[model samples]
Target: MSSFCPNCPDQTIVDPPQTVYENYYHPQHVQVIHPVEIIRQHHCVPVYHHCVTYTVKDKMCTVSGLKKKSRKRK
Candidate 1:
C-alpha cells in the first residue's frame, strides 16, 4: 500500500510477494541483520567493547525504528 520503498527514500516501492501487506522495499534494500562485536579505539588502542542490536532496516543501511527519551523535572 506504499508508494515508495520504506528502506530507500528515493526509490519507488516494489510489491514483493513476501511484503504484500507491509510497506514495500527494493531488493537491494532488504537485508538480514547480523550480530557483530564493536571495539572502541583510542588512537589505535582498544578502549572498550560495545554491544549493539541491529534491525532489518539497519542491516540494509536504512533508518529503522524511532525511540523517544523522557526527561525528568528537577
Candidate 2:
C-alpha cells in the first residue's frame, strides 16, 4: 500500500505514518496510519503539548486499523 510505513510491516501501519510522533509525542510502540496535518485553530496551529491522538471506535482505531477492539464475552 502507498501509506504503508517503511519501518513497520505492510498493511500494518497507515501509509505515511504520523511524522510528529517521535518529534512531539514520544510514545512506546507508536503506530501510525495517517500523516499528521497542521490543523489551524484560531488562524494558528493548535498547540499539542506531548501526546498523540488516534480515535478508537468499533473495535478499531482510525489511524492504525490493526488495533483490535475490546474483547468481551458474549
Candidate 3:
C-alpha cells in the first residue's frame, strides 16, 4: 500500500505547470473534461436580447430533466 502525492498524483512532472481549478497544476495530472467556449449571438426566440452569450456545450443549464427529442403529437 502507498499514498499518492498531492503535487504529482500520477508521479509525473510537467514544466511550467498549468493552472488547474484556479491553482497551479501539472499538465499531465490535470485534464479539461469539459471545455466551454464563449459565443456571442442575437437571440429572439424564448426572449429578446441584443447580445446573448452562450457556451459551446450549453451544459450550464439549471433545469433538470430528460431533454425533449421532438414535438408531441396533437
Candidate 4:
C-alpha cells in the first residue's frame, strides 16, 4: 500500500489554467439637440440729389465741400 513517496522530488502535480484579458467601462447617458439658424438683413435708405445750372456769361462760381451725414442707431 504505497503511492510512491520515497522522499519525493518529481515536479508537476497541478498546473494548467491561464487565459485572461480584461477592460471594463460602462457609463452611458446622452441627450444631444443642436438646431440654430438666424438671418436678418434689411438695408434701404439712400437718396441724394444736388443739381446746379447757370448759363449766360458766368464770371466765377465754385462750391464743393459737403460730406457729413451719418447717424443711424436704434
Candidate 5:
C-alpha cells in the first residue's frame, strides 16, 4: 500500500517488516543479498545499493528494479 500526498501525486512507499535469520549460510559456496529501500527525496529518487547511494531525477525516478549495465563487445 502507498500513501499519497495531498499537494502532490507522488506516493510514499512503506517499508517492509525486518526478519533475522540465525544461520543463513552453510560451510561452502554461500551467498546472500540484502533488501533495499527506495523513496522520493524532494524531486529526486534515492537508490541504495549496499553502501553506495545513487539518484535519478524527473521521469527516470519512475523506473524500478534497475541494475548496472554491462558494455557490449565491439
Candidate 6:
C-alpha cells in the first residue's frame, strides 16, 4: 500500500526577489549676493537675488510574493 502526505509536497522552486528604483527631483531655494555699480550713485552696492535649484533623489523598494500561499488543513 502507498502512503500519501498532505503537509509534504513535491519539489518546489522559488525565484529571487526583484529590486525597484525610483528617481525624483527636489527643489531648493538659494540666495545670491553680488555687488553692482549704479550710474546715479557712481558707487558699488550689494544686491540680493533669489534662485531655485533642483536635487536628484533616489528611492529603492523590493518586490516579493512571486508565488501564492498554499491553503492546507491539518
**Which model scores highest in lDDT?**
6
TM-score versus the correct structure, for each prediction: 0.14, 0.12, 0.14, 0.22, 0.19, 0.23
User: Between candidates 2 and 4, which one is better according to TM-score?
Assistant: 4
Q: Write the per-residue lDDT of candidate 1 for residues 1-74, one digit (tens) a residue.
A: 76985575565776756634667766666678999999987686668989998866434454569566689999
The number of residue pairs in model 2 that clash at the backbone is: 3
The candidates, ranked best first by TM-score, are 6, 4, 5, 1, 3, 2
| lDDT (0 to 1) per candidate | 0.72, 0.72, 0.74, 0.83, 0.79, 0.84
Q: So what's the TM-score on candidate 2?
A: 0.12
Encode model 4's per-residue lDDT on 12-67: one tens digit a residue.
67769788989898989898889899989899998989899978875775566966
Please give, for residues 2-59, the per-residue lDDT of candidate 3 as tens digits: 7965684556666996766766756576666998999999877775668978867545
lDDT of 6 by residue, 10-48 (tens): 898888988898989898998889989877757779898
Off by over 4 Å in 4: 1-33, 58-74
- Following a full C-alpha superposition, what root-mean-square deviation does model 6 have from the true structure? 54.0
lDDT of 5 by residue, 1-74 (tens): 77965685777898998998797755786688999999867776788777867997775464578887999999
lDDT of 3 at 37: 100
Pairs with steric clashes in candidate 1:
none
**What TM-score does candidate 6 reach?**
0.23
- Error of model 1, residue 40, in angstroms: 0.5
Judged by whole-model lDDT over C-alpha atoms, candidate 5 comes out at: 0.79
Better structure of 4 and 5 per TM-score: 4
Residue 45, model 6: Cα distance from true site in angstroms: 1.0
Clashing pairs in 2: 3-15, 4-15, 14-33
Clashes of 6: 0
Q: List, residue by residue over 1-74, the lDDT tens digit for candidate 2.
A: 48875586556555775556445656699677997899776766789789788987677537765776798999
